[model samples]
Target: MNLTWRSSSILPRTSRFYQKSFRVVSTESRKESAQQEQEVTHDQQRDPVLSEEKKARAPFLKNLFLGRFDKDVLGFPELNKARQKNFNAAIAPALKSLMDAVDPRRTDAEGTVPDSVLKELKNQRILGGTVSEDYGGLGLNAMEQCLVAEFTGSDASVAGIVNASNNMVIQVLFPNSISAVNKYGSAEIKQKYLPRLASGQLTAAWCLTEETGGSDTTMLNARAAKTLDGKFFDVTGKKIWVINAEKADLFLVFVRIQDKDELHNPCDITSAILVEKSEAVALSPCPSAGLRGAGIQNITFNKAHVPVEHLLGDTLDGNEIAFETLANFRCASAAQVAATMRGLLTKTIRHCIDRMAFGQTVADFDMVREHLGKLAVWTYAVESMAYLTAGMTDSGEYPDTQMECAATKVFSSEKMWSCLSECLVLLGSKSCSPKEGYEQYLRDSYCHHHHGGANDILRLYIGLKGLEYAGKEMQALVKVMRHPYDNPSIYMKKNFRGLWESIRFNKDNIKLKMHLYGHIHPTLKHISLQPEAEILERLVLRFPVVIEHVLIEHGAYIPQRQMLLRRMADCIIYLHALTAVLARASRSYCIGLRHANVE
Candidate 1:
């Protein structure tokens, strides 16, 4: 059987270049075709002049891979005073009250959140934090939502409950369902669903992960068949580890569209269907080591009837919808992890200050101080990155932030896990006691490492996404280099510039043309200059050269080289962290905020 797959969903608008179709006859051929299609798709998406304009207007970490850095783009984010104040005045107190009322230990032991707590959350509008006010939600922006996530995430189970509704469902549903905004859903569906969803009258579960397809949607077994009249779809599949499944009134399900002609073959096109609770849907609790109160379950849809109008996006655009939803979810996960780390660090610090060891407080020990310092720095960096990404999302300055969101998720989850381990070490065996709850925190952190997508997979995504941008920029140069005789003037001009630079600078020590010295605040600068600042500048300068070399050597096969991808991801993550830290600290110092120097 021949299989054909086409995706214009990667970009919002499909270019004429992507209209061409290809056929795949075998697995190997499919892989090669997909890669070729992806490269061409990327090339079409990034026109040279437009790419430069986008880089300047919406500079992100990917730009660093191509040796572009705009300090102003990395400037510290500022919150809207009105929104912050509104959140503080209305939301903060409710959150405190809810937190005081709910016991995470009890919730974990029972494997469920109490109805009273759920009701309280509904009343406080926490469940609909990101939904628009017209939909009976709090109308909070991305940063504000992160702030709320931070508060709820101090407790793992609570974070799970809240995020399942706010981060995963509402975030995905609202934009796709609102016709006035995205034109993906009918007005009837929006009016019928959004209000109930926002008011918490109806809860939602995102059902995308199947037993066969844990993270890779291509392996999904779920199938949806359109009825003869095309008024409704019959969906049949089982989704694993579905949060809020036990009580969800609505399900945002992903399934392949089974064509009549391809009855024996696996479907290639995926679609999202809004499935209302019905007798055909079955649910069973899925036991887990952590986040027990999140109401996770395995849901089997046996010919579930879904209206055609309930489709979230285009018929063959489930991949893009899923990717975009996961990206948003990852940004929220970063905030949750950051908050969890902050709470853990606070507890560990208090314990260290009070506990005695070797005739002195644990806090006084050099090793303990080192652990605490590292925790402090990691916490700060995670928080900085979380809000920075959140601000970018809210500001709408950046057109594509999937890479940034992935980096934030990877950095926060891994750092939080490490920090939790350190906290356990600092607190000793007592920390593992059930009553203390530190062990639970560690377990939840472990879950987070694999949640959304595994850190390793996200690392590869970051590397490949950045590499794609870099490769597009180098395509023209590579073409010229390959056939220099055909483009002699351009080749000679490029070589002459390179030769001039080589001749001007010593072979061993080349001067960097770009530096952050002028961009950073005066307080961070000194007569001799800070070593860290200088190191960042050097790394920034050297990064693009390294990317070019790797692209030249590996070419299109870089995706298969996991180790190299991991290393590239690490560098990007480090650079992003350093940039965020410096920008935030500089802003803090300039504003004369308390303990700015300490930060």
Candidate 2:
């Protein structure tokens, strides 16, 4: 008998020997072919990428402004660009020189910023940088002021001086007393004060927190009563923890104007101005654990005379202004924290790569890698959110930005502290010495964490906003549900159409499976199998199920139909990733295809 084993048709033979030999050959070839097909199929599955071509690419500016660019936005890119250019070209260079001149690398016995360095910082006009040029100052934007904070934060002393200077500039720029600007001068206030501030010629500090009063401005009791001349207020109070007071040319003191009962609002507070070097004043500097070079002070106003013109805003408006300024300044402080964290991480990563442990670099350790990965993820999330919020505020899309701002501030500042602490751990105690740059970061970060509104307070603010949004969401949801029957016909038609589309979309589901398989086959030859592809396939298969669950769970917060569709989209993308990774891995193994540098 004769047998043809390789034919497409099933072979049958009359002779037992031929039949047996044919069966053995056919079985072996079939197994080999199946294995080859599996290789091909897996490679195809992982071959396709998330196709960068389909990504929505646009400038962050356009994304931010959307359609109402010309009419609605208040922030000027031109203005910011100009200010940034000025900072980079003139201000940053000068400040860098000043920092270098002060020897940023030098640390005293206790990490104190040297007195000479502090003197130079005070002399540099750090206070005048944010005031507009017309206001007897350099007229920098809020963004530039933030950059100065970041620059100074590289060294604690400079950061302290810059903090004092920037806050003072903020106080002068936003006051309701532009008319009083020309009057309070020694011609010197404009000349010596303005030019000095503009040129980093003079620095200043703010005194707001009392021994008893913390975040509550209304609780302040420092008294400012009108003087005999009726043009001045005699301010008498002890203001504590005033930064840069040692060399500050001015002090912004918050005082109570309680006698004017009508001025008592929720935020009713008043500014009692005082000068540091004035003949009648007594300033006692405090020794603080962090910001040792910052020169915190206890100032006794002692009936010190502050010109009535120096009083900022309406007496009742002080609380409002204080809250606003603090909110605005919180963004800057958050930025500084982010920068310091970034720097610390950068330095630590470099150290890890270079330092040997267990006969290999620390970076090679799996545990260390995990920590670095977490640090990286945190940094990315915080940095992106903070920059986005800052851009929003600058562009004036921030009418209700308080919630977002507070959220970003609290999250990023707190994240930065955690990241820094981790970094210090990675560096080890010996490497974390003041001389080594680790301990100072830990110390300075404490101040950064507390500089803005406390995390706890911002959390409360966030909770309030969340509840308000949740209420609105629930009302809209209720309205939709109650009126569901009113549009029965329309709803029927829409549902019918959606069902038709879903049916049509899923009709070629096997083709989806085939296409996915094909895409992954080529990819499998080049790399090791990643679980991402498997997870994606499973997610896609479970897409409809996920939609149902989400509808049941989150229908109140998200519109039912839209949420279903979004889940479906997410599933498709995830499936796409799965197919791509599987294909790539198969292709890598089979044909030695080039593996991507995926990280």
**lDDT to native, each model:** 0.73, 0.52
Model 1, C-alpha of 581: deviation from truth (Å): 0.7
Per-candidate Cα RMSD to the true structure, in Å, reads 13.3, 20.0
Write the residue-wise lDDT of candidate 2 on 366-406 in tens digits: 88988898787666555444444454444332333454456
Clash pairs of candidate 1?
none
TM-score for model 1? 0.85
Kindly give the stretch of ten consecutive residues in candidate 1 with the minimal lDDT sum: 1-10
Query: For model 1, how does the per-residue alpha-carbon lDDT over 262-290 read when each residue is reduced to its tens digit?
Result: 35554467778889999999998799888
